[model samples]
Target: MKRLYFYTFFTIFLNFYANGQALPITEVFNYVIGTNLGGQGGWVNQNTGDEVLVQTGNLSYSGLLLSTGNSVSFAGGGIDPQLPFNAQSGNTVYASFIFRVTDLSTLTDPNGGYFAGFGQTATVFGGTVWLRTAGTQFNIGINKATSLTENTWLPTNFDTGTDIFVVIAYDLAIGEARIWINPAPGDLEAVSPPTPDGTANLNTTRSSLNRFFLRQDSATETPSIVFDELRIGTDWATVTPKDPTFSLEDKFKDRFVVFPNPATNGFVNITSGSQAPKDIHVYDVLGKLLIKQTISGSRLNIQNLKAGVYILKVAQDGRSETKKLVIR
Candidate 1:
């Protein structure tokens, strides 16, 4: 009888583990629009001021799931909402979300401030994403720990009011952090990790991540932003799942052609069904724009690019297509 009872207890424990903490944590902010996010969705308000409120409409990307439901908006003040998760340790943990800046005109600090990050406590944070105004636009950056300023900033400036997918990965064992912005939708973690836009080494005092926090720092430093479809998991595929409804092949079917995919001689040819002049953009895996020019002919020069994988985007008329490119 004791042996039978032990077996029964073990089975129940297994069921709970499988259905609970073992799965990915996702928040679409499904609460009613205009409601305070702190009282709903298991988020605890850390302080008082302009509360993070559920805003109307969801942020969408072409090829990602979890785009349903409303998003939460952070205007300013101290109303930060922190949500706890199963403490993760000894491996890589990934967090992904759809983010957009609504206003940067009020930003007074030149260094900018962090809006979201992973945390061990309400105060201790890491893997933080930051935004700083650059001229009329803004730039996104990442830091590994509680640094006074962002460690690595993307060289490119992004315009406000545009939805962008962001993925942050932190390797606990190696004390390293990496960030990817607007990666291809078909990309999957099971095959390989996408190249990061920015990477930084973490501080020596590594700690387990137990929560994710949305912060509202000083009004002078933080920009007005909206965040939606926050997901946390143990791998990149879990946080950044490809949308089942989108197909890359069908979108570009018979419309464009890129030859010499693995171009060995530093030259590639492009042809389109319309036979119109094409505007070409070549970006490295890091999402950095390396080349931009208008081509009136079939052959384009790429002798300056190093041997590596890149993304080739061609635009003609009012339509555009992107494909993976390789140089050998």
Candidate 2:
């Protein structure tokens, strides 16, 4: 509500066809905890498009990272509800999230600790993205944040997490990627060169990933960023076209809806779009389909059904408009 804008870059639009629609990340993209138990106790929670802002908790490379003070954040964590966490790489990777810097005075890395982009290994240059504390420019290193040899520091003014927000896209298919800072909302420090019909691929190697890495500066200990509505493998979408003022409410995710939540008996309400032909299906926690129905409008009545925790699937009248819902 500070000052909002919208933009689509050309590098991303280059491969705009087929991508006319972005897949609902919360439905497919998953996260297996990197704990000693090998994700036995780790969790992977699906995202709800209602918010353009999803906060993940702390993250790490191998084995569940118990260190929280200076790591990643998850969208809805238990203690640190909105901290960094999920860090993984799969076939189709498109992780997009919005972040705002809260403080830089007390950083983990005094000289700057790989803000936005950080590769698994320092050898992979141009494989990371980062920003300097209270500084301008998108530090796009061809190889790494510290190694400028393969890095390209695209100068800009947006640096603070709250003052600025970025949407990152990693398409493993064509091996391309992009990170747009305050691209859509004007009057902020957004990285330049907007692309409405382009597609980009990242040179960051080292796959078998785990979570989205945006750690703090190595100089200090606490995080200097605050983010929300972190989406993966999809565009800055407008999932729900209804509620007229919907777009203005939440810009991160505009499609998919979970209704009648906080239920009492065993039914819930779900929908995909305002006026699109949709197919509503119910599935169990084990990925088993319980119900599938065709309907129109952004709201569907999911009345009589057994409840314990079912995954509600919805498909809009478009190509990619499916999402999962938890029945209470």
Candidate 3:
């Protein structure tokens, strides 16, 4: 919340859509792991690896940093969570997270280790979306065993003690992937401009994603970085971060009540507390606006929406509130 206060309302408005909607992603799982948005535990479980979870305010979005410490060679892993693994395939899968690095200067490994990203291992081969130090430049690379091919951004992006947000989406069916970087906080679709969107063609068979890892591959390098707010899901919006205060109870203390929550009939009924909502916006997990309806009474007919999770945003008198809705 400290860094967030520095933003002006104008910048915040620019980050979201005109309707004040953001992060359309469905969010299969968001693991802040006891530090930030604590919940049902995730990578903090130490499913694998020896990385330590330390609490720090230095460039941390959630006051937690996953450190790889110093290594002698290439192989020291930081945070390696193998369980509760996402098996999504067929369409696309996305992974988004925030990372901060102390330095990217000593990293010289070409293709051995990874800092953070997703990976899939099948019976024979595997693929990954990870960050590495290419000389003095930081690169986001992808590798797939099927095509025996690899792709990465050219050496241009550099970082030193900065919090960087990365979002990557992989189409399992077509074996294609695209990456967006440091979108306006809540924006999952914003790509790095000037430079073309980071694109890659993984010459491999599409399979269920088996693992997501954060590692410091080069043992010779002692650079330590921290990762926070890691998420994985099916679409762009599913993995994107959304309304920072949406998850805080105090923020929504006596807001409105969204009923028929697990809407079995695809219809949602909303009742505001004391402050009436001027407009109600419904968006898919990917942050795509499904429908915008004027508040006639206090209900919305969602018969057109498919079965899944949706984000509901209510704007009243220039103030806005968000809630997560489920359609069964």
Candidate 4:
């Protein structure tokens, strides 16, 4: 069934692009099974035994179920090719995700389990945020330019079941990283993680970051953690979990217009009448950001995009608007 769906979608996608037709606009990947494009984008399942399960959960969203034996890695494929954080780009990166343990007691690795985080090949430039059985908590372990250190455990009690949202922002320019955790899905943009839930200084300098890892560490770990809504981007709001109540279209209605909706030349013009938008972002139906540009005029060049549906977001003054677009 999965193969059938993939081929079917692939056929449609290829046909549109091959013939210069625009693709459709839809929400990007949010780890929703069946809807998730990770399998095709580069996510690898490295589980030694059982595979990650797609199941309904406490938060009313689809989630990935994992056992002590399950592991996955985003070090290679799953990320969009247009993303800027790839080691080749040298951009600061931010990652956030929501997760919970079905049974916290199952995480009994005294040595700690590398559940999620980013890392580079250079010994001096990797970091892993993991869970250790000793304290039943999550901690950030960073490898800087010369030294590697682990921060204090997060100020949260772990028992059996609870939902936690984690946001990590790493600035390569300063060689520092920070973490934010929320008990529930709150305004991540407005509500900062409580004082005790974050790290102050991660005294490590990095030159390049290669890939993000998920549960790919010591095998001594035996935890069953479930995760949902994993996001990685260059900014805070881009990686934060979003509420389903609001559609992307609602946020960007009538703000800007993209002409030649089915762009014949793979190029479109963006006009906002008088108020010029400060920023413009182009994303695929899967929610993968293809391009981000600071614009002062009314022209957008999408010559590189395959014919498909896209979402164009424009930011002006303090307001933002989203609109559906097509390309041929």
Candidate 5:
């Protein structure tokens, strides 16, 4: 009995550690629409001024999980949101997010400002993403730490009102950072990581990172921007999964459907090409598993769930797909 208990405890500990370290953070901003982002979804308000309001709709890139809920937009002042994660040390940390510049005509700072970055604390930021006007367009740049100027800028200028996907990787071992803009979903899965469009050296010797932040500088320094689908992990693929739309291995890709999405009647009907029994799991915006069961029929009772947005994962024959679920 003693040996069996030891084995069971070891197995459970390994499983927990593996799952805990797989994905350090994922934020879809799937909160109530038209609310401030600070108090919701593990984010804390660091300063005061303009609130980052959650707006309807989300930004998307091809092959990504269908974006759900809403996005947060910021324009001016010093108000920002900070989220702390497990401190990562001596390894590469990767972060990816979708953003768009709605307006930049108000920006006057010649040096521009950082809109997102990794931070050791609410004030110490690095692996910064910067934006500055380039003639009628704008350019995105990256810096390893707090700097007056960007260490490297993309050669191309981008137009306003266009969605851009950005990925940043910071290597603590070497104190270096790399940035890629609009890279294909699976680019990081290659035998070697894809070449970054911009690279920078961490001018200061930093050791660990524990927080992520979204910034809104003064009106003259920052543009009106919207951000969504922020994810951070230890490897490139963890933060930049391939677009599901192009997944040939997804057996239920085009054959599955969920009805009564706004589920007014406290139930949802799922239909798929195959009638095989499916394992169902429902998760909230923070990735908490709220419901889990198996179903052999189309209808699933969800009356116990509160009114809000959720993620529904359906698995059959070892294949699975996730869809956005909203309850009225």
Candidate 6:
């Protein structure tokens, strides 16, 4: 079978032929699984038509839900109302999310469980992306620099629902950070042998810009899983697939906002309904980098920074919106 479809494009074109230069990965958001965190931030409706289905803003709760109710098992770890993103800090930063792992032994350890995923409170930022269940054989990672050096045992072998990508890249001042999880073709599942040594040290807290949680607190809140597009970049990615301006049934596009969301003092009140021309960028919280300008109208002024959490990329006309700011 053409060598099993060339092992599913060898982990999706292995970064455009290995290093020849590729990973400028950028798309920021694509919540297409169940849709809900678009503006009000809340969604968790997976019973996709088998029975017992609710509709309202497409189901609101916390975002990231391609199918909820089939794999119930993660909740004790705490992070249900925590599907937050919109973060980017200087020098080196990369985040990739495309979950579909319905089940993976509810992985837990020195890093934490439900397939292991932490950052917001760990070594720095977060780490852990490995899954499996027959399908195939694949290994992946992305946390390159910030290994707090805990129980360490980052393994990979995912093939649950299919599109399972979790890539993270960072190289701030040689702090070192690299993570890769390429499993799309037949789904290369990799388990064991690649542990206690994958990447870490994201205890990030210099500038502040942390907020990312997938399986929540483990234990098996499974929820069946099915997430699409959860990108964060500094470049170093591979999960390309874009072609949609409006067609998910089309329902009057044009949405954007950024106000009093856990934010304090500083400046954070960017509301929009029309006016167009809207773009603001600021990052701090280990992923480090800081600032990515282009502002026009509304309101934006986080006052010289200091506290933590920042990410508000709003683009009008071209249709783009990303919110999450907290500086205390």
Clashes of 3: 14
How many steric clashes between backbone atoms does each model show? 0, 98, 14, 15, 2, 62
Compare the candidates by TM-score and give the number of the best one: 1
Model 1, 208-258: lDDT tens per residue? 777788999888878888899999998888888776766767334435678
Runs of candidate 3 with Cα error greater than 4 angstroms are: 1-49, 58-79, 110-112, 121-127, 134-137, 145-149, 184-196, 244-328
lDDT by residue (1-328, candidate 4, tens digit) is 9999999999976653333211111112334453322343444343343444444443322121121221122221122211113452355666766566554454455555556666554222344565655354333332222232354444233333555556665667666666655422233333343322344354545666655555433334535666655567666556554555644453344246678888878678877535544567788987677897877787888999998788776655322446688887
User: Where does candidate 5 stray beyond 4 Å?
Assistant: 1-23, 185-192, 247-328
lDDT by residue (59-152, candidate 2, tens digit) is 2111111213222232211121111223334543444444455555554343333444423322232234554434332222222224433333
Q: RMSD for each model, in Å, please? A: 7.3, 22.4, 20.0, 20.0, 19.4, 17.0
In order, candidate lDDTs are: 0.78, 0.37, 0.51, 0.50, 0.79, 0.41
Sequence-dependent TM-score of model 5: 0.67
Candidate 2 wrong stretches, greater than 4 Å: 1-92, 106-111, 116-127, 134-148, 159-161, 185-210, 220-223, 234-328
TM-score of each: 0.74, 0.37, 0.48, 0.48, 0.67, 0.26
lDDT of 6 at 180: 46
Clashing pairs in 1: none
For model 2, the run of ten residues with the poorest summed lDDT: 59-68
Of models 2 and 5, which has the larger lDDT?
5
Q: What is the lDDT of residue 107 in candidate 2?
A: 43
Residue 266, model 4: lDDT of 61
